[model samples]
Target chain A: MREVFHQSLEDVQSRLVEIAELVTVAIERATKAFGTSDVTLAEEVIEADQVIDDKAIELDELAIQILARQQPVARDLRIVVAALRVSASLERMGDIAEHIAQLTRMRFPERAIPKGLKSTFTKMGEIDVQVANLLTEILRTEDLALVEKLRTLDDQLDDLHLSVFEKVLSENWQGEAGATVDATLASRYHERFADHALSVAKKVAYLATGEWTPDTDSIAVIVAADLAAVRENADGAEA
Target chain B: MREVFHQSLEDVQSRLVEIAELVTVAIERATKAFGTSDVTLAEEVIEADQVIDDKAIELDELAIQILARQQPVARDLRIVVAALRVSASLERMGDIAEHIAQLTRMRFPERAIPKGLKSTFTKMGEIDVQVANLLTEILRTEDLALVEKLRTLDDQLDDLHLSVFEKVLSENWQGEAGATVDATLASRYHERFADHALSVAKKVAYLATGEWTPDTDSIAVIVAADLAAVRENADGAEA
Candidate 1:
């Protein structure tokens, strides 16, 4: 039974890596297609996303089965849970790729992005692919050291995302409302792709460390302030 | 042991509703604050989000305990997992509310939205709060009927969001770059808040039905085309 459970764990690990690889390819193609306005390639990325979704569903089922059948305790249980989250993240990355591809498809023949911003998007695509490849490695190894690099990549993506706004704000920007909206959304998609990658890495690290760090922690202070506000409201009601 | 597990499940459920209620309040105030430029109210909502986060973490810890201790199978297992997902969705809703509050705080004493878009945003905030309150009921009852209403509410938000874009695209858009970005992001946050609520409703429906529909599917055709492309590449390599 123990050996069988270990094999199941190995199966999940392999599936995660499979998903990571597939999504990495998706990002690469989507970015390439977005940068060049390749509608055919964009269509391909959009269609490939279904496979990623199917794979994610498969992984989720496998994890749930393992949880029910093996009843893994402690770290083993966390591994299963984290696998589910990572699959969801990877699947979302695929959807982001699809959203990017959809933009390319939407503006076929005419470039979705104006000429001035193409180079900026090119940089985003390059960094997106690099971060995606690193995500593949992170899933495979679960090495804590690699997570920091993903963070740095995410920061760079943020800077690129910010630059999109800078371009929009520039006096030289001649694009209409449609172009600006598309460019903003496209930049957001890439930035969020990296952000999801960062989130997945953080979850994996949590699985490794078993530490709890709530992103929002000052609720107690907020609660006290809230009570005071309620009193003030009561004072208003009386008045 | 079964009784203990059920109690723990009940405990998690209670915590979920608590989080939902708190988040509902957060949304109400954040939007009110954003609409009114009430810096005090905005600060209150911002600070209250920490409490929402804390409650979500507490619920997650409880659900994990149930999983590890009871090792619930099949339906019960799904129940615990769904609770975890719901907690996550609720926590994210708080973050969205916090973001709305942040925008209000960002432009204190000045409106985050322009006069042209105020009526539309007013409508968005109303729909947001309504959907949030409905979500609280859905969590309490899991009544599939409420899901459709939530979807309708979400559609209303989408329409309002589209109007924002329309306003931005119009020749009369008088807001500067910062305002445009702020308006776009605020619209997105409200839309996503509704989207998340819709997602939770779907999740609850899935828990009830045992159906396996991934929200994003139809990637198979893409994969077949992708395979064909790979083969073409291989053939070219051989040539």
Candidate 2:
């Protein structure tokens, strides 16, 4: 029975890594589509999102079954519970990718990168893709070091997210209402993708170190404050 | 042993209800602050969010402990696992309320509703508050009938969310970049709060009905498509 339970745990880990890899692909393709305005690739990401959703559901069922059958206690039980959360976060990351794809598709002939913020978005997308990859690696190998690396990338993505807002809110900005809307939504999607990845990384870290951090959206408040300061400084300079 | 497990389950249920009540209050205050530009109220919501966060963590610890000590199986095990998911969703609902408050405080002395869309956001905020209240009642009563009502409110919130984008993208829009950003972020936060509530409702329904629906962000994609259609039709009429 112990050996069987051990195999079940391994199954959970591999499935998590598998879902993470798929999320990585989804973000990579979605970002590429957003950058190049490849509607076909964007459509692909949209359709493939269902697969990720299904995989997450399947993983959840497996975790529950393990709980019911193996009756894992203590650390083993925590591992299964953590898998449930990691799957949810991964599913959300896939959804963000789909949102990015939908943005590209919504703007078909036109670029979704919006005018004057292409480089910032491109950088943000690249960083998000890297974050996804690192998340997959961390889950696959259980290396705590990758969690810190992922956190750094998430910080960078947050900064880029702030920059996107700064550009849009600048006095010299000339984009139309549609462009502004797209920039705001798209930057948020990109930044949130990395945020979800970092969240998954933290869960993995918790399973290893046994020091759990409460996962809350406190980052938004800090980011919002920084944005307000930057906007105020810009306004003061203009005055 | 069975009686002890039953008691543990009841404890989980009551704690969930407690957290849900706090969320209802948070959304109430946050939305009120957002609509009236009450920065102090917004700050209150923001400061109080940590309590919700801490409570969620405490609840999670309790759930983990139950899982470890009881080693429940079948429906009992599923109940504990579902409690964890529900707690996470409730925590997220609290975070969304905080985000709304942050928006209000960030634009203090300046209304966060954006010009020309005050009524839309006001309605959205009210529906969200209603949604939170209903979610708390449902958790307390386990009345699956309320789930349908919750779904209806969520649909209303989604429409309002779509309309915010429609107003922003319309040619009649006169708001500058700041208003656009706030509308985009604020609308998203309001819609997501309802979405999280609906998700919890579904989980409750699942617990009773034993029918599991995959919880994915498919709603965003559908809403995005609807917005696109609305935009195209408007453009066609203009042409």
Report the number of the highest-lDDT candidate: 2
Give all candidate RMSDs, comma-separated: 9.9, 1.2
Please give the lDDT score at residue B45 for candidate 1: 88
Q: What is the per-residue lDDT of model 1 for residues B1-239, given as tens digits with 9 covering 90 to 100? A: 88888888788777888899999999999999999999899999887887888888788778778889889999999988888778878888998998888778766667877768899999999999999999999989989899999989987887677667767656667776556767777887888899888878888889889874456533323332333344344335546
Show the colliding residue pairs in model 1. Answer: A47-B222, A50-B219, A219-B51
lDDT of 1 by residue, A3-83 (tens): 999999999999999999999999999999988889999989988888999999899889989999999998898888878
Interface Cα RMSD, each model = 9.7, 1.1
The lDDT per prediction is 0.80, 0.90
TM-score of each: 0.87, 0.98
| Best by the DockQ measure | 2
Question: Candidate 2, which segments miss by more than 4 Å at Cα?
Answer: B237-239
Q: What is the lDDT of residue B186 in candidate 1?
A: 87
- In candidate 1, which residue ranges exceed 4 Å CA deviation? A212-239, B217-239
RMSD of 2: 1.2
Q: Write the per-residue lDDT of candidate 2 for residues B43-125, one digit (tens) a residue.
A: 99999999999988889999989888888888888889899999999988999999999999888777878889989989998
Error of 1 at A165 (Å): 2.3
DockQ of each: 0.19, 0.80
